[model samples]
Target chain A: MTDTPSQLPAHDEASIRVDLQLVADQIKADSRVLDVGCGDGMLLAHLRDTKHVDGRGLELSMARVSSAVREGLAVIQGDLEADLKHYPADAFDYVILSQTLQATHNPKEVLEGLLRLGTHAVVSFPNFGHWKVRLALLLTGRMPSTPTLPESWYDTENIHLCTIKDFLSLVDELGVTIEAGFALDGNGQKRSYKATGWLANLFSEQALFVLRH
Target chain B: MSVLDTSSDNALAPRLTLEGPLVLQSGVSLSPVTIAYQTYGTLNAEKSNAILVCHALTGDQYVAGAHPVSGRDGWWHHVVGPGKVIDTDRYFVIGTNVLGGCMGSTGPKEINPETERPYGLLFPVITIRDMVQAQARLLDQLGIEKLFCVTGGSMGALQTLEWAHRFPERVTAAVPIAGSYRHSAQNIAFDEVGRQAIMADPEWRQGNYLEEGTVPTRGLAVARMAAHITYLSEPALQRKFGRRLQDRENLTYGFDADFQVESYLRHQGSTFVDRFDANSYLYISRAMDYFDLAEENGGNLADAFKDTPVRFCLISISSDWLFPTSESRAIVHALNANAAKVSFVEVESDKGHDAFLLDEPEFHDTLKGFLDGAARTVGLDDGAQGESA
Candidate 1:
């Protein structure tokens, strides 16, 4: 029933999604972190409980924002595209945009804004070049509906979806420093391939990058 | 001015008369300033658990008890009782009647000691800042070095903002619910209509209705009726009244409260007239119109909260066209610009601006969460026992 993990009442490590747990794992304790499109603040709350990070959130949906704030997480009801500029440069130690990059109206602009908002930016997105997605598209000659891209093209909000290689090229074009990159398997647990390699783009279902500018 | 404190929780007499003139933002001063207030819960030993709740435009000092004038449960009784969302059992809660209010405070209703008459039109126009200043002095008299939180809805929210802005060090957290940093043009226009309704009454006698011993019930009722519509949404009105007729089934063919909505508004107006003063309404309405946080900070709302240490939680109702969610969004943007710790929740409610006063579970949950989060940061131990007074 819940999109993100339900971390309220008490922190349950098992309920947290793999990608969100990965994002939480990278953040340091007591550092200011802003999670863009942080739905229900599961990751923020997790960080607050485990790392004791000073966490904040920006979510577009009022429902999600209310859920986050109802848990005492500092969350604002706003889009990262419009609201990110209001936050001063380096306002946060880390700005996380996980599983929401493709859904943003302008991914490039949002990435730039996120980079400007924090000393480091952690981003994760579903890879459109995964073998299952490519095979489905090639065999059916229709938009792929893999596990990551579950919804039909007409129904999905991932308007700016891109592959791992595409994302790396944009990162290069932006001249941002990539602190680290990972290519996760379809389950979002095993990091077997390097995000910079074409093999990773073709095989992995998701990609994560820790960037700085 | 005599400061009378029967120390009892009676709504009529608990008050504090400041020793000096209260300098106001209008470059005028109010002498013999008396603040009618009520307190609930015990002040902790460290005095760090004090919370100041500023009341709305017509709201009095009775925040969590039977109101003397209305004889009804307090406006915020649903939220501020012991073990409730605000938990009066833990925090020392204080609610004060504003400076330009009729509720035992220094206002047009009170006699002017110098003239031996009601201040009426002679009373200097008070601003939201003036109300906050009076509240600050009240805090000083109570020996509270800093407030754990200052919160309110509507006009009270404006006072909360002024407190956070003017005395950031004195406030650890602030929650401004269903409010804006400044009054919008439409809001000011609605307030003007209310004022004009009061003034148009022959019984008003140009703000001297008190001296004439004639209450401007009709005009004040009309004003309340008009303003009351703004507090509820179109859907709420549609759901509550719609085209449903009151008492009779068919139209009466005259403007004698044929519709249920009309009857409701009329009842709201007449009842408000019984409890409120026309001059105080005018004064408080004018004060809200004059409140502009951005204007005071040289056109940048962010400047008003520059480097402010206070954590803020702003709650806006979805259908509140009076103080729309956009207004709260603007304030949130400004707070974000300063990197100030802030939370903004636009609650889904068709109840409109009055939802803050109503029992909305989301609003209560958001408030409780924010306060709990802030209390943790402020080092207020929930487990500790409050000292008995």
Candidate 2:
């Protein structure tokens, strides 16, 4: 299948975040995948290299989209909030949204749209209910700023930021089955966590969830 | 006005006049059809390295190197040179003047075989398919049975799609950049306005201006000016001219090219009339307006490529309102429905429809990547790559 040696690089999973690597692991080999808000297409490119998956990407930023296309990735410049409705149901085996869930205007609707587009969806987002953030908010009487959520309140893009517990509850409310979940520390190292627990919300800096409707 | 030299000896590009009667899509037959084309690089022994590059409206056969008539760089010199995206160093690139083109090709300006005069309005209206058929004949003459890739942008894109649809066996890969599967009503309206502008001019002489030894310079210029505006986006215009006065501090009250944009449009119009034929403009624009793949295929776009074996790389520009990304999406959807192998990229560019002609790094990279992949699939060995000499 690898006809072009120069393009098909050997597996080098060390470049991306461990959470994304975990998401990549969940994907079956040779399954079609769509990466929403796929900035620079690192995850998609990695999947292509390791799993031989046929991947497509939808990126919001033109510069990122251009960079992704320049890397020979099949990416289109589009808004995930608006463009997600265009994809047919089960058009892809997996629809992965990494670190961009909180930034959406309607994360719930976006989640629903993702599940509609793919058989399974893998989502990762910063957890705002970490103990450090809670402590900082409690002590300073201001919005907490941490390594994972480092943006100032005024200019931050994480509009609908949620805790890991909040996301799990939302999934339960939407009647979607949680296939798997993972937590990552501030340094992008994956940490084991129970699918439904308060410990994840308190300690995890970021959360990864795989959902199926 | 510079007169077109009909003599073949002084032509910059290679010219071929095919024998016999060539039937056009318009149900008209043209005998002794002449096609002017330019070839870059060398044809390999296996002939699997041939790439046919179709040019857009107003573009000529000078795909690389200086154009003899304009004495300027080729329109696509930036993308088609040595070690560039198309890489003239490795592939034998052939660019032809479309059937209804003015640059040394048989168009409205060409002399009629029977009358011994320019065809003018007597020339049958040609379609995009006619242009592709003409190119296919040219390819036959060149002994290239199958093209490694059939690529183009805008009107050229229409030709590229036509090649993939009409001759899937002959094309291994297709690249249609900043183009649509069919011309929209709005696009047809714009072309109509340009055609009306030419016909309204008294100097047009009912398409017989050639006989009168005069050219419809004003009308052609106005048409070119109107059409040129559609090629660029409002943001591009603002970024370039931005209400800036042309060679002056303040704006003139009267409409005498007061702004830089006005002056720019005027320059574009005037310079265009010098090189392009007014009659050829009418014919080509008509052809573009008549392009509708679905209309030809039982009103189902997917039917155009049903069970075809051709890899496609469809590209659209972000700000190209002329043929917006939505249109490209339609093509992608159709290709997907047909289960055809396709890849689509909507490159972010404020340059609008003309982005395909400009030096957009992402666009070039996408083309290079697609060609490289297609080349690998066709088993064409990668040769030593270097800069064009």
Counting only residues 3 or more apart in sequence or on different chains, how many pairs clash (N, Cα, C under 3 Å) in candidate 1?
0
Question: Which candidate has the highest lDDT of all?
Answer: 1
Please give the lDDT score for candidate 2.
0.84
Interface RMSD of each: 0.9, 3.2
Q: DockQ winner among the candidates?
A: 1
Task: Show the colliding residue pairs in model 2.
Answer: none
Separate DockQ for every predicted complex = 0.80, 0.22
Can you list the residue pairs that collide in candidate 1? none
The digit string of per-residue lDDT tens for model 1 on B91-131 reads 88999989989888898878888898889999999999999
Instruction: Mark the 10 consecutive residues where model 1 chain A has the least summed lDDT.
Output: A1-10
